[model samples]
Every structure is written in C-alpha cells, then in structure tokens.
Target: MTSGAITFGVKLPNLSPLASRDSILTTGTVAERLGFTAVWASDHVVFTPTTEHDHPDRRFPVGFDTPAVDPLVALAAVAGATERVELGTSVLVLANRNPVVVAKAWASLDLLAPGRVLAGIGTGWQENEFHALGAGDRFRRRGSATVEFIDILRTCWSDPSDGFTGEFCSFGPIHFAPRPAAGIPILLAGRSDRGLRRVASHGDGFHGTNLNPAAAGEAIARIEKYAAACGRATASRRYTTLCELDLRDRPVGPDEDHGGIHLVGTPEQVAERIRAFDAAGISHLALRVRALSGSTRKEISNRLSVRAGVEQLERFEAEVTPLIA
Candidate 1:
C-alpha cells in the first residue's frame, strides 16, 4: 500500500460491438508494453432493449442492443496475454452473482495471475439486470448485501475455516484453496455517501467515476473521515478515478470543457490534469476514450474501431505518461 508515484490504467474496449476477443487482448498487451499499471474491464450481464428507463446518469446512455463482454472472462483473457499490468474490473456489480461463486472464480484467477488481480465492485443501479439474474429479492437490500458480500469474500479467501452467517448470505465452513498469493484488493466504486462509507469500512480503496480532481480530493477526505470513525487505518487507502479521455487537440464542444469532469484537450493538458488528480490524493487514473456521437450500438461500434482505440492508448502512453511519471 505504499504510495507516491501516480499509476495509470486503461479500460479495455469491451463495450463496443466491434471489440472482439483479439482486440481486447491487443489493447491489454499494448497497455502493459506502454508502461500502464493496470487494464480494466466493465460488467453487464444483460441489457434488455424493451425496457424503457433512463439511466441514473443521463450523460451516458446504455443501449440494450449494445453488446458487453463479460468482465471476468475479458479480464481472464487480458491476464493470460499480459504478464505485468494488473487486471481490474472497473465496477463489477457484486450483487448480481453469488458471493461463493465469485470468491471461487476470483481466487482461481488470483492464483493464475498471482498478485495482479484487482476486484473493483459496485452495487449496481440496474434493477432490470438484477431481476434478470434472479437476484431481485436481494436488489432491495443491495447496499447491505454488498457489504455482506465483501465480508463473505474475505472470509472465503483468507479463512475458510471460519464460516459466514449474514442476513443475505450464509455459508458453512468449506474448503477453499489456492487463495490469492497476496490476497486480492477490493476497491469499491461509486460516488454515493453509502458507497464511500462502504469503502471506508470494508474496501481497501475507492474507485470513483464521473468526478473531477477537486471532487475526487473531497471524496477522499470524506472516505478518510468515515474510515477513522470506523476505527480503520486510512493511511494506505487507494483512491482512483475513471475519466473520459478526449484526445482531440482542441475542444470539440461543451462536452470537452476544460473545467468538466472529463480529461479533455491536448496530451499536455491531460498530463496536467493527471498531476492535479495526483495532488488530490488519487493514486490511480483509469482512462477511457469518449465514445463517438451515435444513437445506435452499430453506429457507435463503427466509430470506435480497434485501431482508433489502440492509437489513442499509444498517444496517451507517449505524450502523457512521460509527463506524469
């Protein structure tokens, strides 16, 4: 948990339909070669197009027709392809799957990759997804469920001898082997008070999204306060953010405003923004290129070619990493 140097991670292009397994592997390999610290995959079990619901964050819309690669599977692919970069889930909805199954899968993954796996979890916002996964009953209590799930995961990973009994999840003492070599670090994702509180209590770090440097700094302070209240040491708590990257030399529109949450503008500008985040106590910054303007999944996929994605990553590595490192 020692800290000082800022680390950077790139989100694998798993959201676009055009992103094939080969493309995902290529992005991860390129990131590791370029000196990135980690590569992240996002999660979504299912997207029902027929459902009429606006996303909680109106800025980013989720199209049901858009294909999303399974986070765990995608990360496994990246783990096999790259030997250095940490494999991460940007925000895996923990409540969607059984904690026991998740613990086993992650434990095996940790063994396979040794200390290069990061479990970034979240209490998902999609009610439909929960219902689709047969976890509708647990959806109402997701906040508590997430906390309990983490507890279960830790017990299963660190001490199988001690069985777990909780409101949502209970399991008898069972043999779980091949535990993580260094123990996987759990990073909670979200900007809500409850989410931050969970990070303070149960998480080893905070994974924030849609936040500017100033906001991330403030959030870190809040997490420290909550951690202190919970009688937990906050000295080594990791703070990371997922920011939209605009590699264009000039601002395109209101979306690319200098003061906005996204990291937009020239490579130098982006590097300065990374420095600001570092000053804010953010240890890691996960960047994703902004999606092109497209109403349909096909249109968006057409805009986000594997070549374009790789080029953007290369640009950041060459122009921004040097300034930050």
Candidate 2:
C-alpha cells in the first residue's frame, strides 16, 4: 500500500478498570468489530494526584481513576478478543519494566497474535510512577535505556552465540525460544531532537501523539532530517500520528474552546484532515474517540466516559472509516 493507503490504528488510554480487566476486554472487542487496524494501551505504573485546582486537561474524571493493567497482560487478552486487528502499546515505558521479562512477555504475545504486534515505546513523563517501581533516577536515563532494551530484546529473541552487556542491560549466550513469528515493529514516541534522532537510528517506526495538524509538519520534518542523517529516507521509515476527535466543528458555547485543532467536523473533514497527515508522511493515524478540553465539571461527568467514547467510535466508524478506506 502507499503510505497514505496504509490502514489506521487506535490508542486507548486508561480503558481498563484497576479492579478488573473486563472493561478493556469489551473495548478491544468493540474496536476490532469496528474495523480498527490495531489496538494499543498506555504504560503507567501509578496515577499522579488530580486536584480540582489543576488544569482540566490534566485531570481524568474520578470514576475513571484506576491503576493500569500491565500492557502485555492486556494485549494477551486482546489477542484472543479479535482475529484481524493488530495489538500494540501507544508507548510502553521501558524504564519501569525489566528488559528480560518484557522481551519474553512481548515475544509471547507476538506468538499468540503472530504477525500482529506493534511495539510502541517511550521514555515516559511521570516521575512518581518511576519512584513507585524503584526506578527513579534510572527513569531519567530512559532514552538510553530504551535503545539498549530493544537491542537486548532482539538479541534474546534470535539464535545467538553470546549475550550482551550495557550500562542499562545485559544478558548472555543463551537460546531464547520462539521469536516473534514475524518481526515486531518498534515505534518510538517523542518529537524532540534526541527522540527523533533515536527513532531514526534504531526504531522501526515513529509514534507522533497529540500533535495538532499545523504542528505536525515540524515533527515530520524532524523525522525526515534525522532519518536522512542516519542514511535512511522518510519513505522507508514507518510513521504514525495520533489524532483526537471532538464532534463539534465550531464553538457552540464557552466549552468549545480549542476544539478547532481536533477532528471536530463531519466525517469528511476528519477524513480530509487525516489524509493531510498521511500526505505529510504519517503512515498511520492512531485515533482516540473523545473530545478535547473544557470545564472540569463538564468534562468529568459529561464527556469523559467509556459510554460516550464508544459512541464516538461508532460515529467515526460510520463516517470516517469508509472515506479513508
């Protein structure tokens, strides 16, 4: 397929209940049924405190508050829920996970799903979550850790004569069985120089998340620069951007602020906007079904729930999917 013709995926942040896995299971099944190309989850070990005084965009509604299930465990469940959709992470925080164990977990999932694993990774943002895992200072070195981690994962999975040693990881001369039936695509998340450079140098793909269409050019440009610097071309390197949708096209009230950057119009407009990203060099657009920011109270009860989110998904499936497909 042409880069623009490549299928789209979806990212789910905090979709599962901390107490149970059923919510996420249901969501993944629904997304697959809707014909989403892939399903991804976030990696977070703890929740930062949310208070009324904090910005509304920073806070998730109260009932939605819960610890995340380990992504590998969640993906394993998703593997069984759907046959065609790919399974992935929006960005797994490698700093918080043990590399050896993570390699095994992901490899196992790939075996279950075969050629359907997309490995999205990041350095992560929350400091408290690292502390909870006793990986605080080490988390600060996540960029380097991720490079080493991926190298180790590939190393352990292949038939190797010896192990590896690095400041962040080490393993030796042993057989790691059942490598992914097909190679997993490693999509790195971040937009800065170091991040883009790392993606170019090592990653198989790039995850451009929460970027406005206007700002997307700069990120894509950055990727092109780094990829060229590494003697690769943008066309050869895989890339995806995540776009959030709000159903309104223009301001209807005080709550309508900043929804313009979102895919907020009819299905055609959203499709055109997504096509723009593809034209700009994004091979996939990982979308989420939700509105952008507004009043905290309104956001908490009115818009941010699984029920509303699914309705939005149905709307996009009906409208945007056909246009894009």
Candidate 3:
C-alpha cells in the first residue's frame, strides 16, 4: 500500500481481428523490455448486433464483430512470455460469468504467474450480451451481483473452510487450492455513482476510462468521500486510468481535440499530460497505442503490427517515461 513514483502499463494488441497471438505475445515481451510496469487485456464474451444503450464513450460502434481475445486467457499467454510486467484485465465483465468459475480461473492464473495479476472488474454495459450469456436475470441487479461476486471471490481465496451465501451467489463449504501468493487486487471500473460506491465499499482500487485530469480529480474526491462514509480507508488504494496514445509523429491539429480522453500530439505534450494526471493522484496509466490511419478496422489492425507496436513503446520509453519517471 506504499506510494511511490507513478507506474505505466499498455493494453495488449488483442482488440482487432487482425491481431495475431504472436503479435499479442510480442507486445507483452516488448512492453516488459521497455520497462512497463504492467500489460493489460480487455474482455468481451460476445457482441450483439444491436443495443438500446449507446457506448459509454460514443466514439466506437457497439458491435461484437470485432475480434477481441478473452482477457484472462490472453493474459495467461502474456504471463508465459514475460517475466516482470504485471498481467491485468483492463475491465472484465464480472456478471457475465459465474463467480465460482471466475474465482477458479483467476486463482489458477495467479498460481501460474505468481503475484502478477490485477483484476479490473466491472458490471458491464451491454445488457444484450448478458442475455446471450444466460445471465439476463442478473443484469438488472448487476450492482448487487457484482458485490456478491467480490464476496465469493474473497471467500474462495481466503480459506478452504470459508463459504458464501449471498442473495445472488451462494455456495457450500469448498476447498479451493493453490491460493494466490498475495490477494489479487480488484480495481473497479466505470464512473457511475454505483460504480464509485462499489469501489469504495469492496474494491481495492479504481480503474477509470475517458476521464480527464480535472474530472479524474473530482472522481477521486468523490470516491474518498464515499469510502470515508463506508468506514473504509482510502489512502492506500490505487487510482488508474486508460488513455489512447497517438504516437505518430505529426504536427498538432488545430481542430483535432481529444477532449482530454487521449494523450495526443507530440511525446512531450503527452508526457506533460501524464504529469498532470499524476499530480491529480493517479498512480497508474494504461495506454493503448493508436493504429495508423486506414480505411477499416482490419486495415488499421494490419498496420499496427507487433513491430510497429514495439517501435512506439521504444519511443515512449525514450521520450516520455524518463520525463515522467
């Protein structure tokens, strides 16, 4: 729980259909070599064609056609190739899968990686996907279900004799073995009131997305206030956010603005933005390297090969990490 210099991580190249397993593996190894503290993967079981709700960011389409690898499995692959970087799930949808199953999967992963797992979890936004996963009944009560999931995970990890009987998830006394070397840190994602409350009440940290420095500061203040109300200590909890980085060398656009959601422009400008977030109490930053301009997602993915990704990582390490570190 001790604070130190800010740490950085990057998302694995598993978001597009063109991203091969080899590229994903290479991305993790390169990130470790470049002195990244962690390498993160995202989750998506299925994408429905239509949704009543819009995407939280409204920048991307809400189609499940994109080829996103399973976060835990992808992280397991990364763990095998890298020795130092932490394996993280940027935001895994918890309510879609059974809590017991998730606990076992993550516990096994922790055993394989041995103290290099960060579970960034969320209730998820796609209700249609929940229905497809046969957890539609639990969708309406996702917040409660997520709380129960955390309880179940902790119980399963804490001791063999422990069990949980929650309103949504209940299990008899069971012996779960190969416990994690240390308890896996759970970071809650999303910016809703319920999300922040869950972070304060049950999570060890917060994993935010699309939030600027000012907004992130406000969110941290609110999280602290909620934590204090819940009698939970907040001084040691981690605050991490995800940002898209435009590493292509180019002049700043007069009209192009990211609304502070991304680290765009020159490396120096991106470094300055990182400093601002660090000053706002953010402890970790997970960056997604932008793909080159292309006609389609597949084309863009093709352009962002492992070689390109490694080059970008090298540049960031040389130009930005030194400035921030």
Candidate 4:
C-alpha cells in the first residue's frame, strides 16, 4: 500500500431524472465548484433487454425506460457549462462504431474542452447491442479493432495526410483539423489478461471499474509485469477506478464489498476504503453516490434531488477526504 493523494471525480448524473439538461449541467457545475478533479459521463447508445441482463442491478436496473444521454454529447454540454474540471467517458464502446466518425466527434469535443479529455474506451460486451450498431461484423475481434481505432484517432490527430488503413476501418487522406492542444488521454477499461496487456501496450492509464483494493492491486501488478516485459515505463501510467459510494447509514451490515467496488457504510468506513484504495495505488477515483439517485413513481419522474446530491459531495470533501492517508 503506497501512501499517495487520490484525486476525486464525480460521475455526472446522465441517466433518468438526473439526465435532464439542467440536472446534468447542475451536477457538473457543482462538482467543479467542489474542487473535484474531473467530471465523467458513461456511454450507452441504445439500451436493450440484453443490457438489463448483462449489467448488475446497480448499473442499469431502471430498465430500458431510463433516459440516458449520449456520452460525448453530454460531455460537450458539460464542457460549455464548466471549466477546469476534466471531461471523461467512463468507458465508451469504441469498437462498435466507425473509427473515423468517432475520432472526428472526439476531436470536436476536445476542441471545446481543450486539454480536459480523458478517453476511457472499451470493447463492449453486449453482442446484441453490437449487432444493433452497424459494426456487428467486427464484434468478435473487438480487442484488435479497439487497438486499431486508437491508432486511427492518434494518426488523424497528429497527421491526417496519410490517413489510415486498418482491419476495421480504411480512410483516405482525410483532412482532420482543430486538434486538441493537449491531446486526448486514452484510458483502457477491461478485466482480462488481454485487457491488462493492452493497458501496458497502449493506454496512458488503466480505467478500472468495479475493482476493490486487492483486485486493483493485482491488476496493477499484472500491468507492471507486462510493462517490464516490454521495456515500458509504468511510472506515468495512472491508476484510476470508478465505483459507487453509498455513504449513508444503513442496517445492511455494510455491503461495501458485496456489490462491485463500492464505498458503503458510515463516513468512517467510506474513508477507510478510500485509503485502502489509495494504498493499493489508485491515484484517481470517480464516484457515483446514492443520495443523488432517482425518486420513486410518486415523485417527479424526470428530476433528481440535486440539493441532496450536492450536500453529499460536500460531506465527502469535509468528512472523508481529510481522513484518507
């Protein structure tokens, strides 16, 4: 366990009641004001029955009826609404789309936010959803497709004169312009050995989802091992993870480790979990809180208790942040 300062970011409320234009912008505005390092948005083009079955209840439990905004568009809106805070996609399914178009879209967003873009990308798992997208043929080899897609993005961003010709996409000498001054930081998200190898080979950092301290440490070890084998330095490679922080008192005996990676239980327990994560080498963490979640059918369907959410974030900063090692 290494003692290091862990930067905190908040996942923007971009689904259901929190997904409204106002709520999304409000959450970004508040997170920026609270001194959070970044604001992240999750991606999902179209939800299907497969989505519900694949994801755990805590993720897509609201079913297909839940409103989820497109990740890039949501970040663009947040881009115009706030400054200083980095804009990120927790794990955009890059392999499901044409790389040229996606690259252009990301470049446009980077122009708006300048250097504050963290591209957290992954090969999507929903096979049916992959079929829904036009790139169904490439689903089987999405790992390689994703790798080539990053190549395309970097190629176009750096120099588009030659363009790219990869297994999944072939483009002419496209005139791509308005590049991000700071360049997009590519963070790879995966839980497999192949994923860890990609982290060592391609990613500027690892985007860990639902990873606890022990698991996070093991993953980092694998990544370092791979990096050493390839003569790559892992020093600049950041360790970041996303998890839910159910920072409320309850009778459930602290289901912190039961669900994915979560910071549950009292404020003290939450603080301890964060310290453990920090000790495990997580340098940054983006969290989702329950206080800011959706209301029941009796209340407004398209609204979030933003005030409660803000209070919860404030409480974390005041109470938990100070307690971490």
Query: Could you tell which candidate, 2 or 3, scores higher by TM-score?
Result: 3
Which runs of model 3 end up more than 4 angstroms from their true locations? 1-4, 51-57, 61-63, 160-162, 292-303
Ranking by TM-score: 1, 3, 4, 2
lDDT of 3 by residue, 1-325 (tens): 1114678898886765445788788878888887889988888888776752445443441234777788899899999887888988988999878998899999999988998999999888788889999999998999889988888888888874856778877777798887787899999996988889899999899999878898898889889999999999644688999887766576466454356667777787787788888889899988877651111122223344556667777888887776665
lDDT of each: 0.79, 0.70, 0.79, 0.79
The C-alpha TM-scores of every prediction are 0.91, 0.84, 0.91, 0.90
lDDT of 1 by residue, 1-325 (tens): 1124788888887865655788788888988888888988888888666444545334442455667888788888888887888988988999878998999889988877889999999999878889999999988889999998999889889887868889988878899887886789999987889878999999999999878889999999999999999999634777888887757676456544535577777877777778888899999988776542111222233355667777877788777777766
Worst 10 residues of 4 by lDDT: 294-303
Candidate 2 off by > 4 Å:
1-6, 13-20, 48-65, 248-261, 291-305
For candidate 1, what is the lDDT?
Answer: 0.79
Stretches off by above 4 angstroms in model 1 are 1-4, 50-57, 251-255, 291-302
Cα displacement (angstroms), candidate 4, residue 205, comes to: 0.5
lDDT of 2 by residue, 1-325 (tens): 1223756665554443422466567667877888778877767666556422333454332332555677778788878878988888878888777887888888889889999898899988766677778778787788888888888877767754588889976766877777886678888898778998888888888887766666676776877787887787744667777666655443344344243344656777777777777667666776655531112233433345566666777777776667876
Error of 1 at 96 (Å): 1.8
Worst 10 residues of 3 by lDDT: 292-301
Measured over all alpha carbons after superposition, the RMSD of each candidate to the real structure, in angstroms, is 3.1, 3.9, 3.3, 3.8
For model 1, what is the error of residue 193's alpha carbon versus the real structure, in angstroms, after optimal superposition? 1.4
Clashes of each: 0, 2, 1, 0
